[model samples]
Target: MLHCPRTVARTIVYSGIFLATGVSTVLAADPTGDWKVADGVANIRVAQCSGNMWGVVAWEKTPGGKDKNNPDTAKQSRPTLGMPILIDMKKKPGVDAWEGEVYNAKDGQLYSSTIKPVGADQLEIQGCVLGFLCGGETWTRVGPPIPSSPSNSMAKGAPKAAPGAPPKTAAPAAPPKTTGAVNPAPAPKAAPGQKQAAGQPADIGDICLLPDIARFAH
Candidate 1:
């Protein structure tokens, strides 16, 4: 959650628009990536894990912040970085938006929320308190667009190859025998300046891999 007074004020000011626009154009929407919040206070990394969309605090302009306002005393001392804000959101049918609960660390409350990608570079986040005090801001995309995660598809009942299954291609001819035991070939490494592939591990890696998001992965 964006724990800033300015952001909270904007939410109140734009509540009307948030309520009026129930859905936006569903243009090949894929919101999995790092996004800079409207206030530039933090970067939220969103990813599809276990068939659901989740986001977390990836970076903060002023680092080392704590969840002081969290109602649970046990979590008050926890760091805000990597905290789960966008809970288990499910894709809405025929729409390019996801609906779920958002955790507002500012007040330690959960609000009904929806996230919609506006174009390719902006993400609109709107939330309402008791379906009245609605407001949201657009987040700028800071990372490349990501595709559907394999784990997400698998969770959605997509078929997966069984473990230890043989390759689909025809078997290759046997190699000549060697005197000494042959060590397995080392894994390939990324080029010095190669960009990380979308949906693959990179800085902040997969948000779903985080402990907080994993709890709601199913």
Candidate 2:
């Protein structure tokens, strides 16, 4: 059946956000755990690889461990079930979540995935490739492990402020002194040939500079 485009778009956007930011107890360092595939067709071993990366060792198993999807009975030459299928990166820090692409060997289709830690011993995995084709599963921790360091880019420890305390303040400066004496300069008097007492003599280039202002104008 067809679905509304807006609803599908919104679902993908929200799903991406959740996948990108969800929390997990397991470090990106390793995936050493009992990962039950979301489709119930596989069981995976998760563990750490070099440099904080994750590795997934998968095995073919039906949802009920039946012969379905089993390479052994299916006469498949290779058991994709025991192969490492997921690569988790640790190159940059600040990644609070884990995401990857899900490859279906049967159809060669890749789906987007998100993993979150539900507890110290288990994780929640979600995978979705299309609008209505999403699935989820739970994984449990297993075996001895090499502790993975938090991503180098992950945010550091708490800030250094005490609770309920007013912030520190600096001393205020003193105001400047206002007392001062005032003095005024004397004004100038008009030059010769000037009609107004406030007016000065014209420069050599001006008609006003002529001895007879009326002759110059005529």
Candidate 3:
């Protein structure tokens, strides 16, 4: 956690524009960890994967919510529990910034995103259009990465267990029937998550990442 004054997160909501306050900066080191959104309602876990960084909705206080604005019809009501909102981010050469894409669950649009680490804890994450229109928050680090249980770590194709942590066993499979098995059938193709054809939105986003920042203040 960042060592700073207990301040409330307030936004200058000026005709679809947002400016985040409360500033303190330091060397922007590795931004791969759990970060508390400005409003403190959700925790985003950022990690390095496959030579790129990815962020997911690690935990949310929003109860039983689904992606209501997803453009994909088939995935409209998908749960946000473990969704990847920030994908395929690469660190910029010689800068404390990472460039990538951010998925806005509110409008179902993917905006070009960049994250610049201020201090060791604060991160300025802005998602925007071609170059100018943008919105973002100064996220504070919420300690280290949320420790993944052995089972969950393994399930995610990794065994990033903590030091001295024990390995967990997978759930048992169902027993085979004492009869001839039927042949498997092919499944239908999946829908596209995003579009390639381009044209950006005039406003990137309206949702304040952590609208209720005070609720999660330490």
Candidate 4:
């Protein structure tokens, strides 16, 4: 759904990295990194939390501004600073696709976003809700973590905090279930899907998201 030129640019940039470095290496680029949005419009400070992911709008600035981190947007409901966005990603079993919420930076609202990993260096980010009227662009594997300042001791690989600071303990187990409520039995299985016989269409779900959506009928 993205405009032709942007789509083409993203594909070239992302695919080049994928081919050169292989997919697994790219996937290792943690969502928890200091990711700069598209052309450095804003910096999202990301970190993993309780097995989920969270992003804080750390730094943002207008195209050419005095304070790089302070945009001159309204400071009311849509404040020009200090906001955290939470993304919940779940895997769809049938398609093995990642579907999640993407925050709208302008209004501070979440939208349904689906991402499918392709190779190591690219993820097709679909920024839409309806199936057809969607725009998507591939995000290429960016460079490694930015170097830390020498003044920061931890940044220079200082020793970590001792592990003896009260290791996390597991919660006590629940008491055994006593009520004799019988669990339901498994249901009968459905017939298997047809193989690639008689000119069957390819499974688009397994195909890379960008290419697949590009070929999707309007």
Using lDDT as the measure, the top candidate is 1
Off by over 4 Å in 2: 1-31, 36-42, 58-76, 89-95, 105-107, 130-132, 148-218
- For 22-140, candidate 1 gives per-residue lDDT tens digits of 33333237787778898887778777776668888876666567999988899999988888989888999988899998888889999999999888789999999999999988999
Per-model clash counts, in order, read: 0, 12, 3, 2
C-alpha RMSD by candidate, in order: 17.7, 40.7, 19.3, 25.3
* Weakest lDDT window of 10 consecutive positions for candidate 2: 177-186
**Runs off by more than 4 Å, candidate 1:** 1-28, 151-202
If scored against the real structure, what TM-score would every candidate get?
0.64, 0.38, 0.54, 0.39
**In terms of TM-score, which candidate is strongest?**
1
lDDT of all predictions: 0.71, 0.42, 0.56, 0.41
Alpha carbon lDDT of residue 37, candidate 2? 58
* Candidate number that wins on lDDT, 1 or 3: 1
Give the Å error, residue 175, model 1: 25
Assess candidate 3 and give its lDDT.
0.56
> Residue 193 error for model 2, in Å?
99
Q: Rank the candidates by TM-score, best first.
A: 1, 3, 4, 2
| Higher-TM-score candidate of 1 and 2 | 1
Q: How close is candidate 2 to the true structure, as a TM-score?
A: 0.38
| Total backbone collisions, model 1 | 0
Error of 2 at 134 (Å): 2.8
